[model samples]
Target: MQFYCSKAAAEALETTQKGKVKSWLEAAPVPEAAGPWAWQVHAIKLARQNVFIVMERETRFAMVFWGIKKGDGETLLKQFYERMVNLLLCMNQDVNWLNAADADVAIEQILQRNKRYCFVAGVDRSVQTHINEVARFCEGEVHEIGSLLMDADEAAGFDEAMNDTLRSVRGGDYFYPNAVFFCSWARQYAGASDELCLELEARFQRVRHERMAMRVAKHSDSSIPVYEQIMAVLQGKGLKP
Candidate 1:
């Protein structure tokens, strides 16, 4: 994703050690030629595969940062700065009011987030299963939300649920409905009329729970199959396992 930050506004944010900023006001359009003064400030990455350009808005005389991601963050930022300086020098514009960009809270979050895949251990073998599982999860969430809209007793509750589901989907965070795992199997099964979709979701859930059970069993003593444990719980609840 490309993010834009104005030059004057960017300076107000605290800088971090992660990236450096530079000015590109006099950058050249080509290797030997320079670009307009409006195209001045640039934030370069020290690494490869990443680049950022900060352009000035002619009308407002404001600078904005535009970043490209494809390399390590540090390298990209450094290169971005170096390229801006070369471009400016070629264009014959004195570099002024240009410095490294500060790091911010959002940058910290980006660094702290879990970027590595949790299931990378068996990615080759489990890739297909993982894709199917994700599809089932998406379909199930949409189906569940649709059911809730159809069965809600209050108009307010239905509206709220619809809004919430839309927001979550737009934010790319939709997943399996957790309540279905604990609810009566019959109640959960009744939500979907499409037998195939329901079966796919259930199978996906079963395999997931089985994996979890195996992990748990590895550290403990449990002879029961994971499915059996789930079925027993359903039976005790007076629902078909």
Candidate 2:
């Protein structure tokens, strides 16, 4: 199935902060790195069901929604995109770079090749090593959902913590008081992914011994049992509480 944007959808898209996405992407000094609006999509089997994970790479915020009927991959993908775009619009974000893997036919429908492509934006809790890892939330895949949350209750808790985290993010907090929440969200949703890092997941190769080098290293110190360093980093820059 092809992805279509109706007139209403296009008109509605124009009304969003997604335009900031376009504006930001063009003005961004580092185009090669993931933009503030970049996102990643993955379809995985979990709880004996198909789950769609759409994650904003920079923000590291994710929304999990169920998508059944795995027979038509394209159809499922299209549905995922539709919901994701709606969610993005709600959050006042849009996509500049979208990363996925090994699905050429499904991926091509959304690429506009320097045109006004619409997408903008879109996890979690752990039961935490550090905010250091949540600080680097973009370096993993979403398909390892099974390994992270385990079951429905944990997943539900994930959504709750994530909703709270989103509230903090929307409040324009560079570093929130409850920074530990970010670590919990990251550990379950973004950490411990099976896929190799880098946005080019299509060419993502799992190198031997690559498993040892984790994207998120647990932080600790003799002074503190574990460092929730996000606030410390901000305080260093004179972010007054």
Candidate 3:
């Protein structure tokens, strides 16, 4: 139910025409006030463009729209309504006019004729399912690599304590431990040939460094220090940082 805007988003909201972005935030439904399937919106900005992320925690559902403009909140809201209608239709639920009659009528007419419908909730659920399956497989793979590392003569320095630390450390909170595990994993299990794994490791390092640079650039320009505050709130809620 808590709302937290990213630093870039906060800055954009502040600088945007008055009542533009504020109206969008006001229009977004609070989680506590919404239905089980309703979205909780989070604002963010990337490359000077506004973004609104909609999520439903119970279903692990999410949808994102970027590069939003002033006075476009209604457009996004209509889109969300359309998406939900399409989803309900897909599930063979009886179609009824949505509360936003004008918006729903137009969307309903469009959907009535269209045979193909892509629902955000459906897509998000599918993706999350796939991710969970892949994660389970990858965890097994990582465990194999870890075992190899522990048994190898060259891995003498990486003892049980070090391995425990690597596994337990929260990757989202600290970058260095993540980098360490990534490099080790890439080197040990990425490819059959040592040269291939080494090449993959180099590429990973380059990508990681570039992303870090970009993060620094984005966060440094914002005055509010929004990310830290948001993280603190999330941690307080017993969510991952």
Q: For model 3, how does the per-residue alpha-carbon lDDT over 87-203 read when each residue is reduced to its tens digit?
A: 333212111212345434544543443332221212234323322332343345346664222232222223211221212222234222223333332333222256654544455
TM value for model 3: 0.29
TM-scores, each model vs. reference: 0.20, 0.28, 0.29
TM-score of 1: 0.20
Give the Å shift of residue 112 in candidate 3.
18
Question: What's the CA error at residue 152 for candidate 2, in Å?
Answer: 17
Q: Which scores greater on TM-score, model 2 or model 3?
A: 3
Q: For residues 1-241, what per-residue lDDT tens digits would candidate 1 score against the true structure?
A: 1222233223322243558643322221233222122222223232221123222212111111223433233443344334333332221111111122322232232223322211001111222223233334334544666421122133223222221221122235433332122121212222323554455446545654565467656755477765666666546745553
Top candidate when judged by lDDT against the true structure: 3
Candidate 3 Cα RMSD after full superposition onto the native fold (Å)? 22.5
Residue 202's lDDT in candidate 3: 51
With a 3 Å backbone cut-off (N, CA, C), the pairs that clash in candidate 2 are 62-123, 94-120, 95-119, 95-120
Per the 3 Å backbone cut-off, how many clashing residue pairs does candidate 3 have? 0
Per-residue lDDT, model 3, residue 239, is 53
Displacement of residue 29 (Cα, Å) in model 3 is 7.5
Per-prediction CA RMSD (Å): 24.4, 19.6, 22.5
